[model samples]
Target: MARHEDRDPLNEEDLAQIADLPKVELHLHHEGAAPPAFIRGLAKEKSVNLSGVFREDGSYAYRDFVHFLSVYEAATQVLQTPRDYARLTTALLEECAANGVIYCETFLSPDFCGGGDLGAWREYLHAIREAADAAERDLGVTLRGVVTCIRHFGPEKSRPAARCAAETAGDWIVGFGMGGDENRGELNQFLYAFDMAREAGLKLTTHAGEWRGPSEVRSAVEDLRVARIGHGVRAIEDLALVDLLAETGVVLEVCPGSNVTLGVYPNLAKHPIAELRDRGVKVTVSTDDPPFFHTNMRREYFNLANAFQWDADVLRELTRNAADAAFCDDDTREKILKRLET
Candidate 1:
C-alpha cells in the first residue's frame, strides 16, 4: 500500500494547470475582498490614517483574528458611499474572473455600506447590483450577495441589518448570514433576524466553528436553522456533531487558507477540510479574504491539491459541490454547473 503523505510539492506548471480549472466560491466578504492597493488609494484620497492596516512590505498586517477583523473594518472607512461600493464590486468580480472563478457569493454588511438604514441600504444595493450585472456581462463571472450581520455588534443592531436584507432579498441578494467575532452573542439572540430574512425568502448561512467551538455550530443550526455554515471545520472536534452535519447535508464553506492564516489551524495539513469531506460533509473551498490572507482561488486549489494529493477529478468535485450549495437561483446554478462540466 502507498504510504499516506500530507503534501506533495508542485512545480509552476502543476500550479498553472490547477489555475485553469473552473472554480466556484461560496464564502467571501465584500469589504474584506477589497484589494490592498484599492483601499490604499481610497485612504489617500480621503486622507485617512491607514498606516496601521498595512505591513512594511505593503500587505495587510494583523496580529490575530480579532485584529484582522479590526483591520477589515478599518479598510471600510474609506468606502463611504454607493459609488465606492460600486467600484469595489466591479474590481472584486473582475479579480474573481481573472482567477477562473465562474461564480462567487460574497458577504455584504449593511453596517459598513449603509449604517443599517433600509433606505440607504437600497442605494448601496443598487450600486452593487449594477456593478455585478456589468461584471456578468463582460467578465462571464456571476456575483451574488449574502447580506451579513456583524456578530460583534450584538443582536439588537442585527435587527436593522436584517431589515435591510429583507427589503432587498431578490436575484442578486439571495441569502443572509453573519460574520465577525463569532464568539459574541448567543445564537438565540440573533434568531429573530435570521427568521426575518428567512421569511423574506432568503437562504440562510452563518459563520460558526471557526473562532468558537462545536456548540456554536449546533446553535447556528438549531436556533438560526442555517442551511449552510461558514468555516465549520472545528466541528471535527465533536464526532457526533460532525455526524449531525453529514446527516443534515449542511454545506460547509471551508476556507482552508483563511483558517490557517487566522490560526484556527497551525497549517494547511492540520486543517480538517479533507477529513470532513471524507466523513460525508458537503465541503466547498473559498478564499474568505484573499488579500488579507495573501491567497486567491488558484492558490486555494493548488494548496489543497498539494496538501491532500487531490487530483483534477477531486478539485472538480469540490467545484461541483460549491455550485450545488450556492445561494443562486436554479437557472444561475444550472449555468454555473454547465461551465464546470465542460
Candidate 2:
C-alpha cells in the first residue's frame, strides 16, 4: 500500500483488526447505498446511461456534491417498479449479512415510487416488505424502511410523500425521514409532512448537520420532532446544541467515511464522533451510501475502530445502541437483541 500523507489517520494494521466484527447500520440511503457491481449490472440490463456515474472499475465517479446528485439519479432510474426495489432491498440485505450486519433501516423514497400516489406507493412498499422478509429468512438479516421525500423538490411534494408514508406505516415501514438535496432548507418548511408522519404514529428522523452546521440540527429537532439526526456531528461545534442533544437523548447516526469522502470533515481524525461519544452523546455508525462512498458495514467498523481504538465491547455497544434507537416494537427488538447476544 502507498504511504499516506502526513495527516494519515490510521495505519494498515488498525484496519485489519475490526473487519470481522458484527455491526448494525442505521443511516444508509437505498439508491446511493447499492454495491457498485450490483448497480452496474442493473444499469447494463436497462442500458441506462451510467457512464458518468461509474468508472470502468465499477467505482462511482463523483466530482462533487452536485455531480453526486446527478450520478445518484442516473443509478436510481433503473429501479422503476416494485420488483426492482424488492430486488435491490434483498441484494442490500445480503451484502449487509456478509458484512455482519444484524439489522438495517434503509431510507426509501416515495418520489421514485410514483411520486406520492397512495395506491401506487402501497405496491412499492409491499415489494420492499416482501424482500425484507425474504432476506430475513434466507440470510438472517432483518431490514426495515423509512419512507422519505426528496427535500429538494419542495415541501408541496412532501404532502403526497407523507400521505403515502402515513397510509403504509406498518411492520417493515416503521418510520419516516427526508433525504436528497436538503442542506440549506429550513425544517419548518416541511413541518406539515413531519406532522402527517407523526400522526400516523411513525417514528421520525432527518438529515441534518452534514453540509450545514449545528444550527441545522437544532432546527430539525425544533421543527421536525426527529428522534434521531443523521450526520449530526456538527453539533459538537456548538456547546448548547451538544448539550441539547445529550439532554434530550437524541441519537446521532454518524457516518465517518461518508463525512471524510464528501469533505464534510477535513479528515477522519478531525471527525467528532469520538468527541461526541466522550461527551455522552448517543452515537452509532453507518455507511450513508456504501458503494458511492466506497464503504460497507465491515469497513465502517474497521475505520471507526482504527480512528478511536474501539474494541469488541465498544462495537457491541454500537449494535445495542442501534437496537435501542430502532423503530421496531418490543417483539422485533427482542429478536434482534437475541441475535446480537449470540
Candidate 3:
C-alpha cells in the first residue's frame, strides 16, 4: 500500500469528485447491511428482543469476527417474514443510493431466509425482488442477489441451501456462494454444493483468504472453481499465488474497511489491495457490511484516496472492475458500465 507521505493530499474539490463518482459493489451482505435503526424498528414491531446487538450509540456491537456473526444473526431474527425482507431491501438500497452506488450485488443466505427450504425461499426471493425492482425505478440503484450458504452450518446443510440457490437461479439471483466462518470448514467440503449450483448455471464465489492463508484461496479456485474470491487479500502473502490469481483473472472482492474493523490488518496502510491491483490482479472495492464498519461506498473511496492517494480516475477504474466482475446479466452489466463512463 502507498504511504501517506508519498503523495499530495486531496483537496475538498478532489474529495467531492471522488465521492460523486458512481460505484459498483459486488460483496455486500444483505442482512449484514441493514441499518441499525431499521433493525431496531423491526425488532420493536415484532416484539423481538435484540438487547445486546447494538451499542449505546445504536451501532451494531461486537468484540470480534465470530462475535459479529452472532450479532448479525441476532439482528436478523426480527426479519422473520417475507414482508420484513422487502422493507430491508428498500432501506438498504436507499442507503446505497445515497452513497452513489449505481449497482450492487448482495449475498443472501437461504439459511437465513427460510432455513434452506426451497418452496419457502421462493416467497422470500419474490418479496425481495419486488422491492429491488421498485428501488431501481425510484432510487436508480440496481440490486441483485447471490444466494450464499453458511460454512459453519456444515456441508450437509449446504446441500439444501444449494438446492434453494439452484431453484432460484435467474436474472436476479445470479450467483451461489458460501460465507461465514471461513475457519470452520475446508473449501473442498462444499464442493458438492458448489457443483450443484454450477450444474444449474449459477456463478460461483466463496469466502476465503480472509481468515486463512493463500492455500485457502487456491482451494477456492482449484477446488470450488470460483471466478471470484470474497476478501481474498491474504493471497498477497504468497507472490506466486498472487501471480496465479492475476493470470487466471480471479477477481478479489476486497473490502478494506471490513478487514481493518475485524482486525484482519492493523489498518488500511497495511492492507494489500493496492499491491494486489498493482500486480495485475482484478480488484474491486466494496463494504462487506457497510454500517457495521461505519463505512459506505463514498467513504470507501475517500479512505482509499487518503490511504493510497487515489484520485477520481483510479476510483473510476475500481468501479469499472466491479462492473466487469458483477454476476448480473450482460444487459445489466452494460448499463452499469455506461453509468460508470458518465
**lDDT of prediction 2:** 0.83
Best by lDDT: 3
C-alpha lDDT values of all predictions: 0.90, 0.83, 0.93
Give the alpha carbon lDDT tens digit for every residue of 1-342 in model 1.
111254455567666667789999999998888999999999999999997999998899999988898998888989999999999999899889989999999999999988999889999999999999999999999999999999999999999999999998998899999998987778789998999999999999999999889999998888899999999989999989999999999999999999998889999999999888888889999999999999999989988988888766678888998999999999999999888878
Q: How would you encode candidate 2's per-residue C-alpha lDDT over 1-342 as one tens digit per residue?
A: 121222345555545545655577889888777777887787789887666777878688888876888788878888888988888888888889999888899998888877678888889888888988988889988888898888788889989999988988888788998887766467889999999999999999998888888888999888888999888988998988888889999999889999999898888888988778777788999999888888888888876766666655567777788889998877988988888787
Flag the better candidate by lDDT, 2 or 3.
3
Clash number for candidate 3: 0
User: After superposition on all CA atoms, what RMSD does each candidate show versus the true structure?
Assistant: 2.1, 4.2, 1.6
Model 2: how far residue 84 lies from native, Å: 1.2
lDDT of 3 by residue, 1-342 (tens): 453356677888889899789999999999999999999999899899999999999999999999999999899999999999999999999999999999999999989998888888999999999999999999999999999999999999999999999988999999999999999979999999999999999999999999999999999999999999999999999999999999999999999999999999999999999889889899999999998999998888899999988878778888888999999999999999888888
| Candidate 1: C-alpha lDDT | 0.90
Query: Can you tell me which runs of candidate 2 are displaced by over 4 Å?
Result: 1-17
TM agreement with the true structure for every prediction: 0.96, 0.93, 0.97
192: Cα error in model 1, Å:
0.4
The TM-score that candidate 1 achieves is: 0.96
